[model samples]
Target chain A: MALWKNGAFVDDAWREIAEGEDPPPAGHVILPLDWWEQERDAFEGSNAPLGLRVAPGVPIERFARDINRFALIELVFPKFGDGRAFSMARLLRERHGFRGELRATGDVLIDQIQMMARCGFDTFQISDATTERLLRERGAPAYKRFYQPGATPEAPVDSRPWARRPG
Target chain B: MYRYDEFDAAFVADRVSAFRDQVSRRLSGDMTEEQFRPHRLMNGLYLQLHAYMLRVAVPYGTLNARQMHKLAHIARVYDKGFGHFTTRQNIQYNWPALSDVPAILDELASVEMHAIQTSGNCIRNVTADHFAGAAADEIEDPRPYAEILRQWSSIHPEFTFLPRKFKIAVNGADWDRAAIQVHDIGYQIVRNEAGEVGFAVYVGGGLGRTPMIARKLRDFLPKADLLAYTQAIVRVYNLEGRRDNKYKARIKILVHEKGVDPMREAVEAEFAAASREFISLPASEIARIKSYFAPPALQARAACDAYEARRQTDPRFAAFAANNVHPHRVAGHGVVTISLKPIGGVPGDATAAQMDAVADLAARYGHDEIRVSHEQNLVLPHVALDDLPAIYDELAANGLATANAGLISDIIACPGLDYCALATARSIPIAQRISERFGEGERARDIGELKIKISGCINACGHHHVGHIGILGLERKGVETYQITLGGSGDETCSLGTLTGPGFSSEEVVDAIERIVNVYMSVRTDRSEDFLAAYRRVGMQPFKEALYETSKGADI
Candidate 1:
């Protein structure tokens, strides 16, 4: 998966471990929620960086207590229209105070990336070839001015609920 | 009316350019129709039965003469010389090519208007009382708060793709003219013992296949917590609303299944959490918006001799004054409703010529202000009583002097099978027929105030659930059928209309309505008791027996 961070694409270093796959003893690894739940004891003493993949319906409170242990939490949008993950991302960042990297995965379209970022997703896993091509061709369509506060600071800050003046 | 600031202007221009690119991509085959549907809908472009329909937002039903003239220009150029005003106080053009939409949006942006969020599963236009600033009974104008909401909900990041469309209405008068009770969230401006202003928040109300009235979520919420509380409610709904079933995805279903108490508890907890983070509305910004909607300065003048003379000499003028004019808060000024529903005409369809005439009159007599009511009528909110005669003459010349504001001929009907892809039966003809039946002479006037609302299908876009006399059009086995519901109202004393009986054929529906009216006339205590009050007092037994039993005997 091509990981988009800040404004450009970068190599994704983390390996996503599927449910029945064995984990490598090195590098950053992301595990499926169910598998991590069942084998959490094996990683209790390991020094490896960990990440968790959460589906839309999994209540954040279920694993909010263990949020501090993971460096990344990847939220999945089952479909482009399925927006339950947006609310979850906000709750994780603002409510649970999870300051780690929030990644958006599955059905990540160019149109949804701006909103996902506003809702606190810092990285997006782009799989759609069209979206990737559009990103390269047009870059991200940023308005810079917004009516509501977001997780990311709008440039020329403190001009919220209004337009930001250019320096 | 609120004017766009630099922020609003720049944002709209940016959106138009982005949509221009999106449209070009769709045309170039880079985007599939399925992928492009939601994007187009967000900009208020709908693929209707005939062609693309563009719905432009008239924020809180408030616009100036300049904006009205621009709408007229669009209708004359881009559409078939007309536009349809919707129940949510927006205007829709029936025919526009997909390729020309970007240009149309660009034109709209020049007027500080765009169709953003008018459709789709995002927060729709924030509607307010038509007589907000001018109503005699208003506690405070609701348009300022509505403007705040309009800005906040524009391209709302998390809410642009919700389970279902959300609607919010605000009412500030003693009488609920805005129909607040039927929206997803309703705000009623109120004051406490110390005379401090706030809001009474109502949540989860909607009209669709499943119609439900919003329940009171809070008796009073401080003015400062408006956005914070609204964010909380929407967040809770976004997280918990059902996505498994499209029909059951509205916030109303979630509120119903979980109950209002649990919904309130969850929203309050979320509000507490959300308030600490963001959504803190600054008082200076609120005051800034409030200043934009301040009442126009008018010097009191003596009553017009011409107006009085016209009322005495011309019966039509008298009728217009009696039915079409509302009391204004400012002395010597009256609010005039220019009816779009003429006898034997399509409800809410306005010709470009007529729109121009209204715009001209608004600039000449009104405070350069115009308003579109949810009832599908244009309003001159701050018209001086002295200029009534001149305004009436212009209106009469333009075929806009319908003199049927709340009367029977003033109907609310959706563009049914004639235009809408979702409609099963035609609604415009039904409305035209009903208006013709009751159009002539004093029949409608004698019948007193009656609201006849017709919807093409059960989706209730026409608000059939709350009409005093509701008509739902359906198709059963290749035949057009209409079901009638009685006693529904959208006022402060809000109630859902109950089904009268079995459905009627297209030919029989208007007759069915007349028979019901006949029953109402006979049983009513006096003409003062309208159809709804009579139905509530006498119950449905009388109307039902007259409709079905008499039909059975005649057929037999």
Candidate 2:
């Protein structure tokens, strides 16, 4: 899978382990919520970068205490229309102050990339070539002006406390 | 009306371009219909029974002459010869091709209009009292705040994919013309003891398969915190509201499942958090928005004697003046309601010719301002009394003058099975039949202010739950039947209508309505007592007996 990080498509260095699979002696690995829960201590002290993959049903609050310890956090969209992950990403960034690579995976579409970016998703795992091409060519077809203040640092801030920093 | 600034203009232009791209993708077979459906819906495009319907937002029900003319032009050029104004104060075209939708949206964008956030699960139009700035009873015009909310909610990243659609209404007058009580979020502009204006916030009130009266979430919320508080409410609903069942997906269901106290506490916590980080509205920004809504510089003039003379001399003019004219804050000017609900006509459909004429009238005599009431009537917010005769003549000439503003014939009906794909039975025909029965002007004037609302199904888009006389149409054993409800209201004292006995067939429903009205007419304390007042004083017992006594052969 190609990961679009920063701006360009990059090689996905982290290997995601399935629910029943055994973890490889890892350089960079993503673990499911159950695996992370069971083997928390073993990976916490590891020298390699660690990431956690969370589904929609798994509460993000469960990882609140250990949120900052991970180098990357992957949020699953499950389907194109289900947007629960967007809120989860915002909570991780703004609420928990997790300053790490927030990656979006599974069913990530070009149309939703701008919104995901606003909600603090820095990397996207997209399989569709068209979406990847669009991301590379034009970069998230966002309306330059925004109404609500999100986790994006590019948001405009004005004198109004509610207003985002002026772009 | 809030004028679009550079930011607002660019925002809308971008939205149109994005929608165009999506449409092109769908046309090119790059995206499936399922993938494109929500995108179209988010832009207010719907595939109805016959053709695609596009609902355009009329923010706070306020529009200017140019906008109205553009709407008329769109009707004449694009769709059929007319458009239907809905109970939400938006206009819907019954016919448009999917391929032509992007062009239509581009046309709308040129006129400082768009269909963004009009449909879908996110926040819909933020409706307010139609007579907001002009009303004498208003403490403060609520449209400015409504506009603020509109801007905040439009393309909100977190709320785009909500479990169910959400509606918000604001009212500043003593009377609830906006029907704030039955919306997802209701804001009543009020002044506290300290003499500062704020909002009395109501949460979870909605009408659908399950009707509910919203409970007060906050007795008073400061004006500065409106956006933060609203965001908090929607966030809580987004995270906790039932998504497994679409029927139970509204915030109302969440509020119902969790008691009011718990819901309020959760909202309060979220509000506190949002205040800390996400949002804060400055006093200057609010003042800036408020300045746009400042009332027109209306000259103080005396009531003309010619108006009185014409009213006395012409009975038709007198009836029109008595029913159509409303009390304006300015002494010499009046708020004139141009009835869209002509007898035997579709309640809210207005032809292109009529629209152009109304737009002309607004430009000439009404300060170029017009409003669409939630009851499906148009209002000239500032018509001088001296100019009434000329305006009336022009309206009458164009078949636009109908002297039934709040009278019995002024019915609210949804575009039912005939036009709506979701409707199980027809509501427009029922409204037409009732309007024809009560077609007489003098007879309607005698009946006084009686609201009869009809819905095709329990969705209550027609707002049947809050009408004084509510009719709910349903299909029973392959036959169209209607159940009657009485005493429901959408005012300050909002109440859901109580269902009357058994259902009635289409043929028998009109007779049933007449019988109920007859009972109210006979037993009312005086001619001044409206159907609602009498129904309230005497309760539903008398009306129930009058409806079912003959069929059952016994009175309980």
> Which model scores highest in lDDT?
1
Which segments of model 1 are wrong by more than 4 Å?
Answer: A155-167, B550-556
Question: What value does the lDDT take at residue A130 in candidate 1?
Answer: 82
DockQ of 2: 0.58
By TM-score, the best candidate is 1
Q: How do the residues B513-552 of candidate 1 rate in per-residue lDDT, one tens digit apiece?
A: 9999999899989989998899999998879889888455
Instruction: Highest DockQ: give the candidate number.
Output: 1
lDDT of 2 by residue, B291-363 (tens): 9888899987885787888988999999999999988898877899999998899999999999999999999
Q: Which ten residues in a row have the lowest lDDT in candidate 2 chain A?
A: A157-166
